[model samples]
Target: MAHREPVVVTDEPTIGKLVVDASRDVSGLIQKEIALAKSELRVSVKAGGLSIGLFAGAAFLGLLAIIMLSVAIAHFISFTGLDLAWGFLIVFFLYVLLAGLLAFVGLKKVKKVRPPEKAIGQAKAIPGAFKGKS
Candidate 1:
């Protein structure tokens, strides 16, 4: 005959201890989530900075190209028997018109910019979610 050892059963955890444990777990989970968000934002910020630098470099090059093209256009106008001063003046007025058009378009686009609705909705729902009311 085989001998069997006596089994002991432990008592269930108290409500206070359970609540404390759950709170601790939730706090730790929130901390980890915050850390993850910070990590993602750090990466995104670095990429955004790099993209801005690249755009700036491209813009500088474009400015140089525009200046050279303007000089060439002025020379072409002068070659066609217009006075050199008149050529430059015409080019200046042309650039002014172009600038006005660009400003108008940019303003329109900027006016269309709105806040992130989905993120805002989720943020507003967070309190209700924690209260167990979806």
Candidate 2:
């Protein structure tokens, strides 16, 4: 590749030349920033969409697992010689018990999840620090 000599601007350049150079530089900078932002947004959006899709798939599989578990339990109960109707009723009772246990566990978890107090205090202190500095 042939290398060309760089052009040099004189100290006594015309007003029009300065204006043109500044405008070109500013427009190039803006175009570069826009391209960078667009690239970042594309990557972030793709990852977010894929994450959502995976979560949806997980939820669907979890529902299937629950259905399979209920069927298995019902079949196990019926193995004891009880009628299918009675077995299903027992499964329903077991489901109710499981639901109550899950609700209690969820409640406990919610109670344990306190706000980020230290983080909040530090964030609040930021404005004060900035004010004092100014």
Best by the lDDT measure = 1
Residue pairs with backbone atoms closer than 3 Å in model 2 (clashes): none
**C-alpha lDDT (0 to 100) for residue 86 of candidate 2:** 88
Count of backbone collisions in candidate 1: 0
What are the lDDT scores of the predictions, listed in order?
0.97, 0.93
Per-residue alpha-carbon lDDT of candidate 2 for residues 15-117, written as tens digits (9 for 90 to 100): 9999999999999999999999999999999999999999999999999998998888888889999987888899999889999999999999999998999
Model 2 Cα displacement at 54 (Å)?
3.2
Model 2 lDDT at residue 18: 90
Top candidate by TM-score: 2
TM-score of each: 0.60, 0.63
Residue 98 local lDDT, model 1: 98
lDDT, model 1, position 128: 100
